[model samples]
Target: MRRRFVIEAVMVATYGHLLVPSRPIDYVVPYSTILELYDMRDGSDPVMDNADDDAHVRGKISELIAFFEDPLNRKKIEKAMQMPWRESSPLLLSDEIQFTVVHAVDNASYGEFFDPIETELLLTGSKLNVPLLSDQFEFQDRLIEAEVPVQVYDIEDFEFAVEEGISTVDAGLRGE
Candidate 1:
């Protein structure tokens, strides 16, 4: 039997939707190897075991959403967070040079703000030696749908949207 895992990450980059001044973010990728990815559990609190790393990622996602509260200053914050990192190159050198894009949002309405960024990342991936040729490509098409309680953020008057359930994945995790 094939075991599945859900992973969530935060990223900041420029695209059609963002106002401007956003920077390419730097995130420490977890589950680097396929073996590590396969070992994750689907219990109520997957990240609770790795509190430090998970907390940092959640904080960044909150900060990113908060930045949206002020459209004028959005780009400035993104630019400040941008750091230089080695990105995949055009040459088909080796597997290490390839990359795939995984999308994540701290809140429910991800399709709103994330679509443009996802498009930009897809274009970038097209130039690399990655294996994301089709939307159904294994490993590349793993979409982890999750929901954190609305109280996770300091913002008030929040609304949540839910995606249609799929027969494959289970996302019944409780949040405090």
Candidate 2:
């Protein structure tokens, strides 16, 4: 029998989508099986000359919460969450999983985020080695130096075409 290993941790980067498109429902929904950690930093500081970046972050979070709370969207979210584990290998087993949220604005901070966690699987494994962000290479090097039994997977690479949908209400407000 195949060993069933529960997802021990889900390390999510800021602004990264945890949901994917569901063609049948024509909506995006959250993953049902695994818990997600939004690795967010306290955005107390102003991001630009006058922009309140923290408020923007909070607004985004509120929008997501509203999406999840809608009765019309619940079924789709549930279906999406269950589909992967039922059709394929189980990503998470029945256990208490560790969910860590690390906040970093730059590479040095991102490297510091990994110092404490014992990461076994790093999603988008191929991208981990690629220096997409200033600190990515250094972060990868740290993972290597620490010998943290890490496995990488490029699961999201397959869902590259899905466009982020904007709500009709928002569109109307924008006079689109």
Candidate 3:
């Protein structure tokens, strides 16, 4: 069965609709998802558990809505959208992926390394190579690459005017 994942990549945010027919809900992607992608490219399973979208992405969506709805952070958000690692989308997995988590290795007792996230773009069977923010982690300086693409989805893909803006109340997780 196909699994859902979040890949944090540097991508431009699109609204009102997507090119794909599957993505129907509003969601957000964090910066850590890319590490899983890197691991996947390196022939590692990264995670064996199902890690679909969750509260964190929703929280980010809420934050984005609140930030943009105010008409104050609009420009800043818009600019951030264009920059890499600023915006993200969910990735549709092809039976091989199953993950979504913050890039952390605080499990010193476990002795592990953590790092990237991506769910912003989707191009199944297609490979992707992105620059890493090496400074974020100690070992990242050595691992700076990503590959393969999955189904991509935008958080807000419904018709909404910039002036109209989406309110946290109106743009609820369920779009209720």
Candidate 4:
């Protein structure tokens, strides 16, 4: 089972770009309207933005959002993060791509609930060397040892991303 706790880090980050905050609706609030509802087009404040191009950002992010939000899909992704993904089925990164890691990340919010998720993914999936694209290099040594070839991954031709080897991860989250 996944554990939860208070995170002490001054700031936190999570991999992937489809996670959005769930806004519970209250019919009693007469002032609220569907127009006021948050949309994925309004992206979050980035820790760093390295993407120069924005063409595929919306499509890719939306595709992932749908995958993660489904109940059966989320469970599979959680299992992948917990165990070597090859032991289970691969996830659909897109309609044509069935990757080993994918899911809804609602409870996987930063600070407390999801602090260890990526760490656990690296730890558990070390043996499989799954094709991963992550911001955190928590287990760089293991990833390298497994011959998984850790190079910078970016769709845009941003010089900073290439120079700094930081892949641009854009996620849509509802900000307060």
Candidate 5:
């Protein structure tokens, strides 16, 4: 069986430009580097300004991607994979963040939860019933204080909702 790894990372828009065809832009950035950029952006004296050019943004994104994808980093990730799941911290940076590495197939059925604004990425599935962290409630309160929206849902219920939506769409397409 082919194995796929999901490395949950903080989302960052390093570069964005309007395309003639209106295609959605996608950026692949390392989790830690993006967090650093996010902090800078949120800082009182931001590193980036509205006048920043696309070339600079693109260059930074490329540099960070290359840095993270280097052989040394790959070796680190592989080494982490070999450690006990509970003890291992998969992503090299961001001790503040937590992650659980599971098979990609398991993720498909159980679903993953990500709170971009709070930088909380979770790996969950129906195969495992992991308890929420004690501090998760405090984290949500912090998000509320920061005026960030928070929504909580059961994984199994979410999966059922998604499957129902997909089936409904399929039925509509088939004129049922």
Candidate 6:
């Protein structure tokens, strides 16, 4: 679960170069809790499934996915923030990336309404070890006079924000 959060963070950063914010950025995050009698089998339809199938099981999964998939939901997620992300020139320094993290908070929860699951993903310096590329680098005094700039940072350096969430229940207790 932690790994997924980290991956999502990096993905959001790297893809920011390709993403444009569509709304006023807010930072209040919404956490969800689903209460189900039991769990469901993967790929099994609860509507026509067996006795083990739970009625509210699929609803929870669908709701969870929808919250993170819809653009509207993403807007809502950003609404929980302190500052809004606007169009800026390509990032060139570690400080710029760090600025984003200061306002990034964990406001996600996944569990049953009563007995739900909860996880937290906090960002620290260790989480963002790499720096954003300031400028293309070249070997100035090489034997050959070839002049080419090389990409020096991971694509994740550019990710500015995220509008995603995740949820999971306990193990061995699936409804379907």
TM-score to native of every candidate shown: 0.23, 0.30, 0.20, 0.32, 0.28, 0.20
Q: Candidate 5, residues 50-134: lDDT per residue as tens digits? A: 5454445545545545544567655554454463332222433232222333322222221223344234222221112221121
Off by over 4 Å in 5: 1-53, 81-106, 110-121, 124-176
lDDT of 6 by residue, 1-176 (tens): 11111222222322434224332222211122111112322455443344433434354445444434457544544453334322112221222221122222233321211111211111211133211222112211210132111112223332332232111222111121
Write model 1 residue lDDT over 137-163, tens digit each, in one string: 222332222221111110110111011
lDDT scores in order: 0.26, 0.30, 0.29, 0.30, 0.32, 0.26
Model 3 lDDT on a 0 to 1 scale: 0.29
Q: How much is 35 displaced in model 5, in angstroms? A: 17
Q: Model 4, range 55-98, lDDT digits (tens) per residue?
A: 34444444545654468756764564463222325434443223
lDDT of 2 by residue, 1-176 (tens): 11111121222222333232232111111132122323322235432244565556545554544444456444444444453321221222113211111121122323444632222123211112211111245555765575433322222431332233332244332221
Q: Could you tell me which 10 consecutive residues in candidate 2 have the lowest summed lDDT? A: 97-106
* Candidate 2, superposed: residue stretches over 4 Å from native: 1-51, 79-139, 146-176
Which one wins by lDDT: 3 or 5?
5
* lDDT: worst 10-residue window of model 1: 153-162
Ranking by lDDT: 5, 4, 2, 3, 6, 1
Task: Name the lDDT of candidate 5.
Answer: 0.32
User: Backbone collision count in every prediction?
Assistant: 1, 4, 25, 3, 0, 23
What residue pairs are clashing in model 5?
Answer: none
TM-score: which is higher, 1 or 4?
A: 4
- The TM-score of predicted model 2 comes to 0.30
RMSD of model 2 against the true structure: 15.4
Candidate number of the best TM-score: 4
